[model samples]
Target: MQIDFTPDPRLYPFQSRWFDGSRGRLHYLDEGDGPPILLCHGNPTWSFLYRDIIVALRDRFRCIAPDYLGFGLSERPAGFGYKIDEHAQVVGEFVDHLGLDGYLTMGQDWGGPISMAVAVERAERVRGVVLGNTWFWPADTFSTKAFSRVMSSPPMQYAVLHRNFFVERLIPAGTRDRPSAAVMEHYRAVQPSAEARKGVAEMPKQILAAHPLLARLAREVPAKLGAKPALFVWGMKDFAFRPGPTLPRMRTAFPDHVVVELPDAKHFIQEDAPDRISAAIIERFG
Candidate 1:
């Protein structure tokens, strides 16, 4: 079944904008007005992940949240590469296409690297960045690496496609907020079929594969971002990212960037701590 890409003002509270650019039809929310704040979400989530933050900040800042090509309301056309590098490239194009200047980027999960990559590629356009529960370097522990391998395997494909394991089970497992049934149902609706769910499996596979370009990106993006205003908000309870390692590495990597740790929050920090996240974005960028 084809997923709905329509932007419902009541459901999303913003006009949906689409641009084919060179890649394809990408869905995004452009709300309010001022310096643009580009919000990028991780795997298995979309622009909807930033719903509350957008609602809070739209009055003061122009919020732009895009569903990556494969996820959310974007067109998941055939023959597209959903690897981390491809994602970052698409974001760069998206920014250029819209002519966003001196904007701020806020990304979570896979968004961390993608947004940072764009900042590195086009430093002139990005003024600052807010990274939440995300990683610029690899954060895999022994167990986590083992888990990623299994989840990216063929067996997990069946789980993601046939059973909704990625959204219904795994995502909530990583969060303390325990998203409501209606919210989860909305997530499940986006990738209602196996074909559309192909990206659900591909992203983890890309992470597990750890493409060489990602290693270069990991090494390079941070250096470029260090010169910009950056804020790090960590959900300390995130076992998937492991507070023990990723958080400290983040602080050490950019010693001067502001950091906020929410002990109660988890991997999906937006669900667990949208208010704090919103406040931090405004504090850092507003």
Candidate 2:
């Protein structure tokens, strides 16, 4: 899988692997050799988001992180609907294609719903779960509903597709320890064109459009995965998924759950406190 852009090797030092699954050629990183831990990413980011965690725990854990089609170095096919349910379907296919079993699932932001959708479907194969500032239920709150309406508006949609709003603004806004210029470029370069950013643009719409899917997840996730050992590493300062109702829902869903709150960290906990997240994963599931 040849990407048009080159990531700063210093920041993303891992071999690129390709999975020609049912959808298309998907880009992913498969590192280390142990009990597999599937790392699922959210919007505007890719497998690159999990680089530090992969490097930190590759020695003991098999880290398999894939870029959903239309998001990273993966091939974005024409006419593909970049919906959350579609992404989950593709991820589930990717999981089945790889024949992964007895693995821990880790997700943040949109990654939570996407990967958990996969986990619930393959409940027997999964071991433990790790989640961070993310939600899997319908957007009913005033804040989230307002956010969806604003981001899904025509002007904001244009900004996301044409101006690279998520990578340029949201990414930095959501993180406490800001990413460097070079690191930011890696994000920008992945979706350099408006056509390339269709996936990015669609996600904001999914916040509203994917209500049915999210509602199903809310019911199914707890019912299927409530007993699994879960770790919640929350970024307390995240404006989007703030320390509020979402966390409580997670607690209710996963009874055997440990909460590690990071007061300093923001939304992108993988970026803000990868070391702490890595340490917590090692302590809990290592």
Candidate 3:
């Protein structure tokens, strides 16, 4: 199935606008005024990843899910740096520009670290956190042979962005059950222009498990989170962060939090088990 690059009117009905003088034109869905529930997505996915969740929760809580600058409807500037710090800064500006204070957050995959950075910097603005198929620590959960091979190969970068090999091969292989054709198509459609693909391509090359920044962030997050109401929803079948390592770390870090593992689901828990996950979020936050 081929992805559609043209914006979907149904998915994005609101008028998209630029924030912080065209750093990017952010795509956001704002509805039913109240304290915001910010939803952050991971790599290769965008605000579209939260469509079902947004539909499920918008009536009860104000939903604010933005496509990170390089991901979805947001502008993907050519030759831009897509480091963790850069992403965190953009998220901070995105939230602050709207004057969102004391809002809850839902994060998955890369969203986990990015949102934590936001919460750490703007603790006063965060009321709660929900983690889905994500991790904070640089544990040995993802040192698979395939992953290691890609990490070691310089050619992997070219395969990922230029050829879409990462999405075409790695992502599907990581899941126990293949994503629906529609969902896969949507994921493929969001890639930015060729010039903008530099950041997208370079992401895998930048991953270094022993990086000091990851360690520092991991150490700081647990202390910062404290006993704030948190929800950990996991997909046991996830290949990247399997139950053995990921769940234990979460349990160790957040002993008091609620943790649910859907044995049949995969890494993209929201896509594979949307109804169940959405219900869990509603029960916890509603």
Question: Would you list the C-alpha lDDT of every candidate in the order shown?
Answer: 0.80, 0.91, 0.71
**Residues 1-286 of candidate 3: C-alpha lDDT, one tens digit per residue:** 1123665567544444446424555556665566689888876677777777777777788888877767776667654577766777788888888899889888888788788888888876778888988766554434743564574376776666677665667557656677777667666767634544554565555455324556766887778775578888888888787788677777776666888777787887777676777788778778
- Could you tell me the lDDT of residue 271 within candidate 2? 88
Q: Sort all candidates by TM-score, best to worst.
A: 2, 1, 3
- The C-alpha stretches of model 1 lying farther than 4 A from their native spots are 5-11
Residue-level lDDT tens digits of model 2 in 171-284: 999999789898888899999888889998999889989999899999999999999999999999999898787799999999999999988999989889999999999999
Each candidate structure's TM-score, on Cα atoms with residue i matched to residue i, is: 0.94, 0.98, 0.88
Top of the candidates by lDDT: 2
lDDT (Cα) of model 3: 0.71
Per-residue lDDT tens digits for candidate 1, residues 214-234, read 676667766776677778888
lDDT of 3 at 45: 73
Least well predicted 10-residue stretch by lDDT in candidate 1 = 1-10
TM-score of 3: 0.88
Write down the RMSD of all candidates, one decimal each: 1.8, 1.2, 3.3
The true-structure Cα RMSD of candidate 1 reads: 1.8
Worst 10 residues of 2 by lDDT: 1-10
Error of 3 at 35 (Å): 3.0
